[model samples]
Target chain A: MNKFYKNILGGKAGIIGLAILAVLLLVVLPSSLQIFRLNLVGKYLTYAFVSVGLVLLWGNAGVLSLGQGIFFGLGGYCMAMFLKLEASDPITTKIQSTPGIPDFMDWNQLTALPAIWVPFKSLPFSLFAVVAVPALLAFILGSAMFKRRVGGVYFSVITQAFALILSLGIDGNQGLTGGRNGITDLRTLWGWDIRSESAQYVLYFVCCLLLIGCILVGRFVVSSRMGRLLLAMKDREDRVLFSGYDVASFKVFVYCLSAAMCGIGGALFVLQVGFISPSLVGIVPSIEMVIFAAVGGKMSLLGAVYGTLAVNTGKSLFSENFPQLWLFLMGGLFIAVVMFFPNGLAGLWESARARLSRLSPRSGAAKKIIPMPAMPQASNLVETEPKLP
Target chain B: MLAYSLSEIWSILIMQGFSGLSLFSVLLLMALGLAVIFGQMGVVNLAHGEFMALGAYTVYLSSQLTEAYAPGFAPYYFVFAIGIAFCVAALVGGLVEWGMMRFLYKRPLDTLLATWGLSLIMQQAFRSIFGAREVTPTLPEWLMGSFKPTETIDIPINGVFVMALSLLLTAGVTLFMFRSRIGLRTRATVQNRAMSEAVGINTGLIDRFTFALGCGIAGVAGAAFTTIGSTGPDSGSRYIVDTFLVVVFGGSASMLGTIVSALGIAQTQSISEFFLEGTMGKVTTLMAIVFILMIRPKGLFPSKVRS
Candidate 1:
């Protein structure tokens, strides 16, 4: 029992439990338990999952992908395609129902469910595809990019272009993908009643738990040697390369992990929201995820969760109250965070801890209780000496 | 007397070219401001479009004022307001540069993020003040109507005027950049900031004036644009992407590049529209540009190095 508690507190076990709980609360609990706050929490958890993945890839890799929405959208559209197909009437009825021909087999009169969509009838394959597709793509892209060692603004610009192309492509191909308006109107997931107030509440609960799990796991990952190497690469790439670590592999690992996490987030979001639209995944939303991390504290695992909830909540209210100025307000928040608080909300907490310790120098417990400030100061060597290991 | 005579065909072609030139001129003007900002300051300046919007709103306000207080001089007020919008937008540009952009210089990505935020604010502010629907600016009577150059083509009087104005403006700006003391200093600052700083130049002051100048030119573009098109709070959003494309395709660092790319893009787009359907033309042009960018990421006129 002591070992279990110690291991949990030590980080790895704690993170696993957190991840399990989060998945359960988000994926399992909502439909089963019927809790309300948990559903909202579940939604945020999905966002957190994506945000943390961003931290892993962008935050550590020093390659700011302003178009992660491509992966997020891919996962969303895939799942949406399945749901849209299922509720849609089958073959003979579909042929009778569809005008002229389906967008896909346009020449063909056969309106039966396409072979591509058959796997989606089962939950697992759709789930696997959503995560796997993005993983494969990012893995390939990351390998090509890292091998060449493309860095700085050029890399940033290219990724942004990639995002633009994806958005435009999806918008252009409306027949199969549902195009600009995106897929909607379906309200059930698998066999469960998606509209049931009880189901929604349970979903929200699971989301909250999943979020906690993501935080713990994120904390564990960043706390590991792999995390240290990511930070090192971010700061001193050449040095890390000389130190004999396969920088390419490290990057590819993070890239795929982030993509997979984004997939999970997208899947959870679709399940809860009962719809998936390409609108949710785009350069803007992808960029917004970055803002959440930057605002919450890029270095801190918990900050992603904190930033997502805070900014999204602000977006919800301010967008309604001051529709015109909402962007300005959001910009003000971003500027405020970046300029004044580069370390984000987490940094502020760290500073507060530092001040408390300073106020009571004689209190020996302050040394142990305070740990390290969360700020990613250049001089973190002295401040974070003890707790890092 | 013949409609297809060489003289008539020549005149019609000249008229078409004139319209093309006018379109190119405005595009150049907008592109120039963006070039200066990106060139001198190393900022992508997403809010460049918003600055243009600010200028348009200034014109709108001035129009409203003239209608209410001085009906006789309402038309003349437009000419006057164009200048004012330049100064007004420049002033706002300077303030934003100092408050937000100055701090973000060290972190380029943060600058992109921050400016994006600022753009949203500017967009919403305009939406609230100007309303969502586009504002219709009543053009001066003299500026409206077309001049028949030949049997086939009827050229708008304003198109010729706009073309002439754009040429004069470009000539004036080129002279200012090449010959004037402050202009030379601005160019020097862009060329070699560290060296210029070492030689006792105030790079910071140069940055301010450069940003202001670029924004001022955008104001002029916005004022001129109100003649033919719709001006709304979100008008900036429409132009921002195009301006960036112009700047990026032309090469972010050069005034000459901005002019050439703008003219080239405008001609291709217009001519393509003549050939293909509206959207296909756009798609084709966008694809062609994207393909070009793939080959030359720094754009047509890239500076050799980041410094």
Candidate 2:
């Protein structure tokens, strides 16, 4: 238990980062922002969940899954299905041709509840499906690709294709998946009005708490022995494979973990935003999620959170004011981030601190500062490290 | 399914197959450029689609100009416009290669992100220049009509023209790649960068030229694309995934693989659309490609390489 706690918190630096993030999300933002703005932040924080997962899968494991939106959408859709069911009670939906089905189903002329959606009528089952569905998918895809020794650009392209397939599938099945309009008019969750201001505040807190929890979970994984193997595998797959470890299993596990994290984020997104749509499940949104991780410093879990907030906040501000310039600015951001800042915001902060310490009068003491153990250089030689049995 | 006569089914299949052939031509054109860039150089140019879009807009601009200033030259202008589109797209492609791609050769993933950025910038530029709405160029009268090969089977003249152009372009590219001295040097570099450099090959110049040439083909593709459909700021994006899939599914390095895969993908998609909804057909096509990729991760024809 003590070792687990240490893994989750890292050392002093991780604790400090976690504390700062907690204060900002749980205390500072809530105290400062209006309900409307806080809700927006909550929505942004939900995306942070995906970015955090990317840091684990892409940054740490060197496996970039561009179809994260699939998991996110799956989770959101699961929640939306439950809420829609709750909203479509026989008494309330009596005016429709089908007295107990969702309105979209009625509009699509679905006479009965589809067999697929029947299981989602149970709240516990729906909640379970939110994470399980995404995880199951990741397990299948990850095993298929990794076991075959497929990595790098091929994996990225294939994942993007999956995202495309999912979005089109959802868009095509109007009655089953709510089509392009998506699962809307989600009024309640088991008779609790989710659209209420108080509920929004509560959901916001829930999102923040869950986000922090996810970061800790990510921190745990990154600090574990599995994390070392992942790093070693990323740089030298042949060496790791020759070491008798099942590389594919490790990759599949991390991928599944990331998918589950995205699932939670999507569910929270539906809860906070009051709707879920196919727009969130496509190739574009999946790639955009990657940028959030890239912007935050894919290596830093906390940086992923900050990256999501910063980029999303920038997106909102730019689109709200100078809508025309947003795409250009976003494009430039992508270019600049890749060209100038490959390591992202965390790398910049680390460098700035290094420079500041170098300029300080206590340079001798500064020289003793520990290099961040987590942000290992890409070319870091595994041969220099102690051998793990 | 049983409603149509056997002869009618044959005619319907012929027409659908011809339509698929037009799609195959466009896919081949787009994939050819991607093959050169990604297959030879190992750089994921996400902005390849945008380069294609650039060619389309160039053709659109030329059409508008000829209509306004020189009505008499309208018919001949399309042939020139396609050439102009190639030059413009190639010039821009060369600039982008010099400015961005050169720095990202070692980092394939980073190249993807950077080109995605380039694509966004290109898309926004297109939106700013050409309004957000789609614009279709006026085809020459000769390019507009259908060619009725039989009473039951009619093919669009533009489809035939585009197919011929793509075949010409493909043949030209194949010859240039196999027969030319530069092509040999490009192949040498792909096989062994260090050895090629030792042999006095100017690899950097080859990279830039090949990238530009690829972009030029994409431009021609854009010109071909304008004949069939309208061009919008985001139209290139729609095709980017499908084109990339074709290049990948074909086995990236092999030109023959790309052509075959393009034909297979297009026919499957078109035929499936006949049986299913439009989006469902797309989903089915994509799912099949992904499933095939899972089994054969190296694609249909895995190229022999030392690595």
Candidate 3:
């Protein structure tokens, strides 16, 4: 139990970090910010789910999926479908040509609910679909790609193409998937007024707690034996494969796990934001999700959350003041993050702490500081086998 | 399913095929540059589309200038513009290679991210310079009308012109790559960088020029694009995925593969678009490419080289 606590919770430093994140998210922000601002933060925390997933998939497993938005959008759309159905109750939607169906469906001349959407009517089903749908898709995609050993840049490109296809598919299917306008006017979840300020506050807390839960899950994964295998596989896949482990299965497992996390984030996103759209599920948003992971120190679970928060905050601020400049700033951030700070904020924090400990002679002497070995740098995370023809 | 007459179906097929050829040319142009950058240098340049856009904007600018200051040169400005676009885009590509890409040779994924950033910056720059609205160059009178090969089949002259230009560029590139001394050096460097360097070939310069050449081709693509569609700040982004897919669907290294894949993709998309909705056609095309890629992970004609 002691070992479990230490390994899973990341020992003393990890516990402290979790405590700080919890207090800040649950106590500090909720108490300080207005409901509107808190809701926005809640929305940003949803992306933190994806960032955390990226830490596991990209950071540890060495698989860079540029289409996380597909999972996020799927989850959001699943929740939105249920909420839309509830919102479009027969009594409320009697004015439409076909009552009880979503307004977008009516607009697109869908007389009855589509077969795909029928399962989403139940809350339990919708919730399950949120995670399962993305996981299933991830499982299919991951298995196909990994089993063939199609990885590295090819994987990223294929994932991106998938993102494009999904967005285009949704946008094209106007009657079925709500098209470009998306499944909007989402309100009420199981007789509860989700739009109310009190509900928003509750949802924010729920999001924070769920986010923390995900981080813990991530920490547990990273500190386990599987994590060591993942690290080894990432640096040297050939060696790992030669060592008699099913390498493809591990990759698929991690990929599906990340997809599930993104799905949860997406569901929470729909809950907080009141609508789900194709705009948030496309190639652009998919790549942006990666930046969150990249900016947060892809290797650090806690850093992913902080990175998402920091980048989103900066985006909100920049876009609000100078919308035109935001793209430039964002571009600069992408370049700067990749070029100079490859390991992200977590890396910076680790190095800073190392430097501080080295400088403080008294503390070092009193604590009998054991000189730790250097952490693996991002540069070493290159593909061992050449991908070029 | 059989709604139309046989001749009508033939005409529709012919016209769609012609339009597909235009798309093929544009895609081929874009993919050629990408193939060179990705296959030769192993750099995943997400910003290659921006170079194409740079070329497009150059044509737009030249058109604007010709109309404003040199009205007599309006008919002739387009030919010069294509060349100027290539030069301008190549210059920018070379600068980017020197400033950014040189530092990211060992890190292909990092290059992808950095190039994405570079693309974003370029998009914003385009937005700032030319307002957010899409712009098109005024084509020469000769390039405007259609060539009626059949009574019903009205093939757009611009489409034919773009195809011819792409063919010319492709042939030139093929010759330059296979026949030229610099091309030999580039191939040698790509095959073995350390060996090439030890043999006194300036590998860094080769890398820069190869990247520039790729961007230059993309610029020509952009120039060709203006005849088909308008140029926007985000136009490059719209094509980036399709271009990357084309390059990947083809074996990344093989020019012949790139051409074949471009043709296959363009034809599939255009013909499908004729029957299905616009977005559905795109979805179908992308899905097909992905499916093919899954079956053959290294692409249709992967080069036989030992890792």
Candidate 3 lDDT over residue span B37-90, tens digit each: 888887899998899899999999999999999999888999999999999999
Clashes of 2: 0
Kindly report, for each predicted structure in the order presented, the TM-score of its chain A compared with the true chain A: 0.82, 0.95, 0.94
lDDT (Cα, tens digit) per residue for candidate 2, span A91-121: 9999999899999999999999999999999
Task: Give the 10-residue window scoring lowest on summed lDDT in candidate 3 chain A.
Answer: A380-389
Task: Tell me how far the alpha carbon of residue A127 in candidate 1 is from the true structure, in angstroms, after superposition.
Answer: 2.1
> Can you list the residue pairs that collide in candidate 3?
none
Candidate 2 chain A lowest-lDDT run of ten: A375-384
The Cα local distance difference test for each model comes to 0.72, 0.90, 0.90
The prediction achieving the highest lDDT against the true structure is 2
The DockQ scores of all candidates, in the order shown, are 0.38, 0.88, 0.85
lDDT of 3 by residue, A256-315 (tens): 999999999999999999999899999999999999999999888999999999999999
- The ten-residue window of minimal lDDT in model 3 chain B covers B298-307
CA deviation > 4 Å runs, candidate 3: A363-389, B1-7
TM-score of 3: 0.96
Which structure among the candidates has the greatest DockQ? 2
Q: Report how far off residue B14 is in candidate 2 (Å).
A: 1.9
Off by over 4 Å in 2: A1-5, A368-389, B1-7
TM-score of 2: 0.97
